[model samples]
Target chain A: MAIQREHELHSRRRGRNVAMGLILGGLVAMIFAVSIVKLSQSQSEDSTAPNYVPATAGASE
Target chain B: MADVSSIDTREYEAQFGDYVELLKPRVMRLVVFTALVGMLVAPVPVHPVIAFASILCIAIGAGASGALNMWWDRDIDAIMKRTMGRPIPSGRVQPGEALAIGLALSGLSVMLLAVFANLAAAGWLAFTIFFYVVVYSIGLKRRTPQNIVIGGAAGAFPPLLGWVVATGSISVEPVLLVALILIWTPPHFWALALWRNEDYKAAGIPMLPVARGERVTRRYIFGYTLLLIPVALAPSFTQIGGIAYFAVSLVLNVVLLAGAWRLLKRQESDRDADNFRAEKQFFGFTIVYLFVHFVMLLVEATLRAFDLSITALPIWF
Candidate 1:
């Protein structure tokens, strides 16, 4: 009976750990997802093409 | 979490090394570098002695923030392996002592800046410390994952403060510099968080990687890096930087984006190999990238004073 009780306690502890891990993991994941979406949307609106200007007066305008 | 009552009184020791560690010297170095850049790049010239004094006060203010952060986060620091050896956690310095030192230094730094430099610079420095300690460390760090993103503004203030010290007023140029640092902070810190997620997890801190999976963190990292390229290039569109700055920024941004993309592409199993390398390279290159960009700005400003037009880049994006 004692041995069975010990095994049950161990399983309960394991279950708690997994639950905590998943909760924390999910929270972190959500943060990253939101930040990425926000950033990417902002990027899409801003053009990536470079507009180079001449460095000197002699260079073609 | 261990109760404060459970801590052994006999274990606490206020040692010299403990006080030094409380300062977060590593972070202070970056603050000093960025502040120096701001001072150097300003349009108005400051005397060498005053510049040195201003930077010193800024460094002290940064250290004060570090000490306060360490004092407040002692509970979580004890749990996180990465921060386990911190002065408070290791019992080398009592928490109260750390708090005292931080608060004292914060006041000293601001007072000295105001007396020796200008009130404007001192006011900004005080605000930065308050923002870091109260706003970011206490209010934001644990409660939200957007902590670093928002908290990044505190770190971004040094350069602007430095510029104000030289010019005695705020301007568009300093604002652009602050914006660049503000945007850069998210990806830089998040990259570190990705590799150290486990530490954050064990400590119960909700860092992006700890709450989010690695894949999502990688994508976020890439997106931020992509955004940073244009932000870094913004100075080129101002009176501050010329052709030299633009050329360096363009090349550096391309390299940084490629590195970020490579990091995003790696699988979990291969993270330690490819992704780690990419992160390290991008991190290292970022230091040089900012340094070169600022140096070019200083050079361009110097050339302009001599009536030599190296380049007259547009003043807006």
Candidate 2:
């Protein structure tokens, strides 16, 4: 009975750690996803910007 | 029957779980996030698909480093309470197997980045893996109290690597991002070390708290936390951030400094339940503090691109 109780306590402690890890991991993943989406949106916006100066002109000048 | 039992014991070691507890997944997420931010914030424009490839390579490289770190630290890990249940220590994974996996992943990640991204990004990725596995884990971790201070540079590389991926070169912005993370690392880690000093002592690892007295360690932690505020506020002066980031940085730094001061001033005997709880809160807040700072930067960059005036903070040239 004592051995079983100790085992249960060990598993309980492990469960807590795992839960904390999972929560933190989920938050990190969400942040990464948000950053990626924002990056994509920014890139699209940049592509639509007007290019008054010709790409080759600056190099030649 | 006894002979058969002995033979069964030899054959029945726990199997490895590649999908779980490799520490790869956790480290990979940090790498991906920081690198993505770097790519997005860079002055040079990168193609969307190329950017994706760059983040992916950085993630793989980070994972490879984690695997190598696991392999190398397996021995020490088995003795430490915190790491006692890691795959290798728990007999779920063999050291040789981990070594092979780490090497294979390291080569593949670097080569893929070199081909798909730029040589500079790939070079940084390779160096990151080398620094984590060789310089930090093997050279500094066991030998010095300044382990995290120097090893922190290994973790700081992802942002710089990401910048190179986008711009095909390095610059002041990425260096500043690297510096912010490097400065933040010691306080973040030392707080945990303070609480878990006993485990480190038992494991014979030369963490700051284990090597130096806890009083000295607390002073170091306070000093780092104080230094981190200025560095954290640095982005606000740069073109990357604005008044919103500056406000957040100011308020957050005050809170962080307060926590560090409290931790620093507490007596040895007073490191009981309440004190420990306070330290834990500080540690948890530190994580959110960093995430919020980075997220604000990302938001500011997006606003700048749109020519939207969120705040009138001066942008450093």
Candidate 3:
């Protein structure tokens, strides 16, 4: 029997690889975004309370 | 061109779509919708980004559980007419691949929820997955005719988890939504089981219609639909509901009861002639029934958020 010219297996592998790349990239971006949001949220909470100055800031050595 | 069977078919590989099929995207849509509604209707306002992220995590968790279910149920899936074309049973994907995908996604979703949301929500997500895959799928499914009754809780958890994600604690409102799904499940599933009775029987599964007899199954479905009325209406008593919710629930419950009553009268002769038309219709409508309830909750949330709600104050806690 004559084989089909199309590399169906290789084509599927290539598509899967491309999809994996896209998903991984998206996940990395999402994690970065989440981290930024977490940091900003904590910072805003800190800003809401009274500001504190260290005792050593004005003390002479 | 190649003779189809002459190609080196042993090296056949699954495409990306097969992997996606393992996630059960259709079911994930329901999870996403319910969870989103559950989060939005909460008294606490969540950050938009956090809300989006939380919904995505919940969806991933649902997908993971679905993959796990497919992996475990591949045997029975192959035997069932309904599920014979699934990725694993169709030989498009391997069981180990499904197991790995399920585990990996499950861990990723839980970790993300813990970091971005709260530990309580993450723990709930983990527990939900465990309940579905281990408790329901492995332990109860083949063993008992009451499997659907208990396993239904697995599907009911997403909304409650969403509420927890937003509020960082469990509350009466989300629990009511969970109960609503729980009440809706057996009837919806049994309706399908009634029509697909032979499939379950051939698979040696103990679905209600197969084990309890069709008449009994119909009665149970009717009973559950009757029971759905109060559980579906419970949200109206809480701060979660508005005027639209009450009206929608009242109307939908009546329609559902009417549908159930019609289904209850279904006989074997009717089934053989029309292939359980009433059961099929009842099953389809039950899906719509649950969906419309949640959609009305969203509508009520919108009204309450704008201070346009008629029933602005709850009559009781």
**Each candidate's DockQ score against the native complex?**
0.01, 0.04, 0.26
| Global lDDT of each candidate | 0.78, 0.79, 0.87
The best-first sequence of candidates by TM-score reads 3, 2, 1
- Kindly report which residue pairs in candidate 1 clash with one another: A28-B211, A28-B212, A29-B211, A29-B212
Superior candidate under lDDT, 1 versus 2: 2
Among all candidates shown, the one with the greatest DockQ: 3
Better of 2 and 3 by DockQ: 3
- lDDT-sorted candidate list, best first: 3, 2, 1
lDDT of 3 at B158: 91
The ten-residue window of minimal lDDT in model 1 chain B covers B4-13
Evaluation by lDDT, superior candidate among 2 and 3: 3
- How high is the DockQ of candidate 3? 0.26
**Residues forming the 10-long window of minimal summed lDDT in candidate 2 chain B:** B1-10
Better of 1 and 2 by TM-score: 2
Which lDDT tens digits does candidate 2 get at residues B63-85? 87898899999888888888887
Residues A1-61, candidate 3: write the lDDT tens digits.
5544656555657889899999999888888887776655523223344433244232111
Off by over 4 Å in 2: A1-61, B1-16, B273-275
TM-score of each: 0.77, 0.80, 0.90
Worst 10 residues of 3 chain B by lDDT: B1-10
lDDT of 3 by residue, B1-317 (tens): 44444545655578888999999999999999999999999887778888888899999999999999999999999999999999999998989999999999999999999887888899999999999999999999998988998899999999998888888888789888999998889998999898788899999999988888988988999999889999998898888896788888999999999999988886789878987777888888988889999999888889888988897547565
